[model samples]
Target: MAEKKAYPLRIGADVLEAMQRWADDDLRSLNAQIEYVLRAQLRQAGRLRPPVPTPAVEEKE
Candidate 1:
């Protein structure tokens, strides 16, 4: 498994509350919600790299 990287993030209370609400509504963890938002913004800004394909899983009896 890849090692996880961590960063310290600072946000205004209002913005944090809004993100918390959105995360809850979407059934996503707060970290995931933040990542999703950041990824979308980066994509829109043309700063995103090409996506790598994930391996497919097979079902067994």
Candidate 2:
């Protein structure tokens, strides 16, 4: 997994409530739902690039 960064977000109460409901319906956490929505929008706008896969490191015995 890539390193996850944390940033504080400010969302309007009404918007947050709607997202919470949607998240529940989609069986996703609020944060994951938000990211999913944003990623979809970014892809629609041709602004998102495919993530590069990280190579696995072999463990030394």
Candidate 3:
């Protein structure tokens, strides 16, 4: 499993409520909802960065 970085976030009450409502409607957890929203915004703005460290296969000795 990949390690997750934790950070503190500050959101206004109205925005928080809206996010909670969106999460409920989408049947997704709050964390996933936030990630989805951010990714979509980045993609729309063409600011999404490419993934780093191309995947590679390992061979056994």
Candidate 4:
């Protein structure tokens, strides 16, 4: 997981309420909901890079 940086946001009350409801429906925290929506939009707009796949590890006999 990436370290989260805290930044104060200025959102309208109606938007915040809507986001809270969405987060509740999705079983996610409000912050996570906002990040999820933002990430989806960024991916759709090709503004964010795809995640890198981790290499598999070998087991010792």
TM-score of each candidate structure, all chains considered together = 0.79, 0.77, 0.71, 0.87
Off by over 4 Å in 3: 1-3, 50-61
State each model's C-alpha RMSD to the native.
2.8, 3.9, 4.2, 1.4
lDDT of 1: 0.91
Model 4 CA deviation exceeding 4 Å by range = 58-61
Give candidate 1 misplaced runs (Cα > 4 Å).
1-3, 55-61
1-61: candidate 3 lDDT, tens digit per residue: 2587898899999998999999999999988899889989998899987557768889999
Collision count for each candidate, in order: 0, 0, 0, 0
TM-score ranking of the models: 4, 1, 2, 3
- What would the per-residue lDDT of candidate 4 be over residues 1-61, giving only the tens digit for each residue? 6788999999999999999999999999999999999999999999999888998998999
| Residue lDDT tens for model 1, 1-61 | 3466999999999999999999999999999899999989998999997587889998998
Task: Give every collision pair in model 3.
Answer: none
Better of 2 and 3 by TM-score: 2
Candidate 4, residue 55: lDDT: 89
Candidate 2 C-alpha lDDT tens digits along 1-61: 5588899999999999999999999999999999999989998899998778888999999
lDDT value, candidate 4, whole model: 0.97
Q: Whole-model Cα lDDT per candidate?
A: 0.91, 0.94, 0.89, 0.97
